[model samples]
Target: MQDKQLNKDEIAQLTEADWKQRLTSDEYHVMREKGTERPFTGVYNDIDDKGVYRCKGCGASLFNSDNKFDAGCGWPSFDQGVDNAAIDEHVDDSLGMRRTEVTCSNCGAHLGHVFPDGPRETTGMRYCINSVSIDLDKNEH
Candidate 1:
């Protein structure tokens, strides 16, 4: 089933309590608290189906199945987002390292981090995302 997308205005109105109520414990931890799921433990880590991945927090379209690739990184790796505006990237300086953190643009929910190492033949970018942060809508066609 396709989920309804929320606009920025709608997302802005959501309180932390609302998010806590809407998301599961894992989803709340990953998406709202900026936590990472254990490597290889995510539902989408080994998924090879055709679909669009949406933000679990707000149902905003984030990654297309065509952009997903197995990076052997124990996560759902994508070369790019569904579009430039589909994700918001920020510089993360925690864990004594610097990395680009990717988030849901509409809801400002943490998704994961992006790395420079990816398939050279493609965009050469790897968006390592947490499965709890997103929901996949399998395409019928």
Candidate 2:
């Protein structure tokens, strides 16, 4: 979590070797390769910690624990995000399945998918996210 993406000028100034030194293996894979971690397999999958979940790639606040829900799916699911601007939704037809892919708006890093099957009283939106793609900020108060 200590390692954050710098501005364009800062990152642009760094060589390939420098970038490698600044990032962890997982961060490099998810951020640079746009790959996904296995479902129900992330460290935060079972986390009961209280905090805001931010995009690991850009440190943008994405979700709050209060909004998280049990989707019975392998990944972490949320009924709501911090705000509309915190995430972006795109139409994804990859893998022959039509779905909306959600990404971190701040850095355009893929977090996971969105489904219309959410609580009826809620937004009817399910943000299925990858745990490794996020970093939690525990509240001290």
How high is the CA lDDT of each candidate model?
Answer: 0.90, 0.77
Top lDDT prediction, candidate number? 1
lDDT of 2 by residue, 52-129 (tens): 898776567889988787778878889988998889899989889899989877666678889999777888888988
Candidate 1 per-residue lDDT over residues 1-141, each given as its tens digit: 225888878888899999998899998999888999999999999998998999888888899998999999899999999999999999999999999999989889999999999989999999999999988888521
- TM-score of model 2 vs. true structure: 0.82
Candidate 2 structure lDDT: 0.77
Clashes of each: 0, 0
Q: lDDT score of model 1?
A: 0.90
Model 1 pairs in collision:
none
TM-score of 1: 0.95
| TM-score, per-candidate, Cα-based | 0.95, 0.82
